[model samples]
Target: MPQSAQLTPEELVEVAQKISELLGGKVKFAVIGGAACSLVRVASDAEYRGTSDLDLVIQPNKSYNAEVISNWLVQKHPKIIRSVEQFGVRIPAIPIYRGKDEYLVEIEIFDVEAWPNRQQYNIADTASNPMTTLTFSPDQYSGSSGDWKIPVMHPVWLLREKILSQYEREGSVKERTDISDLQIMLQVVDPKSLVLSAHNHVTALQNLMAKRPDLINKLRRAIVCYPVFGD
Candidate 1:
């Protein structure tokens, strides 16, 4: 297997901007996974873990389908997007290369309302359940780029997603990175905010927990370990 390298923060922002432009405001989406972690870290001036790909969760409207958007992106930006591989039904993973380094941008189309009784575990579904967005100004991180208002998953919800991913992926290569991201997020997120996030997305969390009863202990440990201050 060939080793994959992580994209720099600047490159991540650049790729995201390109994708946003390519879509031409046709779909509503938000950055998730390791890429979102990097964006948050860049904005907060905190150390971030390197990731090999960018993951986006998109909610496509009736006028446009997610699959069509993925096809269109590859067709429009053949030079930048090397190839696109579809996983199962809705996910389209696009590999992009810059010099010797290559990275992936994965897009997933999900509708929580439509699939209220979906089987199988989908981290994207949980991550975007009560989706949150934040703006990223590229000029603040890298002087060469302009401001990019990117929608990003809330750090708290991301924490929940990572915890579920860690348990579900057990021995996978990405499991270690998931654990690291969880720890980083726990440090930065306020305990009160985490509590509120859990409350707001209680239904999603309940469904996830019911699917993976084993995750309960890990979730508890994560919250218990978070540092808290008292007056």
Candidate 2:
């Protein structure tokens, strides 16, 4: 379900806001995967290449009642339809189709899963980036999103995701993105944990340069590691 649209930065923020209101105050959520770099906007012009459809990791809360969300969508939405998909869990996804295009919004809808476990580590790693203001403003949304300025990924958490994706899509071009993302993530987060997590759930990629210690050693000499700190 790959659809393209000319969305301005404000439009993206507006969508984020609408989501905020729909879900109720920015309960914990993280913009991970390709969407993470799209949101981070931390890379320079040349580095800003890969982008993907929106996929969010929502921290389940009281306001995000399953029945309530479905009911509200039914009441407010006249165009979209709801359905569930089996992806190792009873996951529900709402597809808002316009014409031949379908915008897929899938919710894993879990609580206290991996967010907290990696939050501290990610916080520590991501803190090194003092550049809060990005090309896209996460602060410009309509509803609340905690205190986030730009949509961010915790190094450890994001690394885990990359590792997981690597396992699931062993031969995908997306592996390139995952590798680049892991390279950046390791600059601040614990490299050992990143490797461990990458190998555990990461069954996708047949051979990742990041997973190769010798290749990783080569990268250390190439990619500039500018580790920063945050609270």
The alpha-carbon deviation from the true structure for residue 60 of candidate 1, after best TM-score superposition, in angstroms, is 2.4
Tens digits of per-residue lDDT for model 2, 33-144: 5655544434322244344234455444567533444445445653543444445444434454457776555433323334455433233234431112223334554354
Clashes of each: 0, 10
Which one wins on TM-score? 1
Candidate 1 residue lDDT tens string, 58-121: 6656765545666666676777654444554533445556677655665554433344453112
Residue 86: error of model 1 in Å? 5.3
How big is the positional error of residue 1 in model 2, measured in Å on the Cα after superposition? 13
RMSD to native, candidate 1: 7.0
**Per-residue lDDT value at 99 in model 2:** 70
Worst 10 residues of 1 by lDDT: 222-231
Number of clashes found in candidate 2: 10
Residue 56 error for model 2, in Å? 1.4
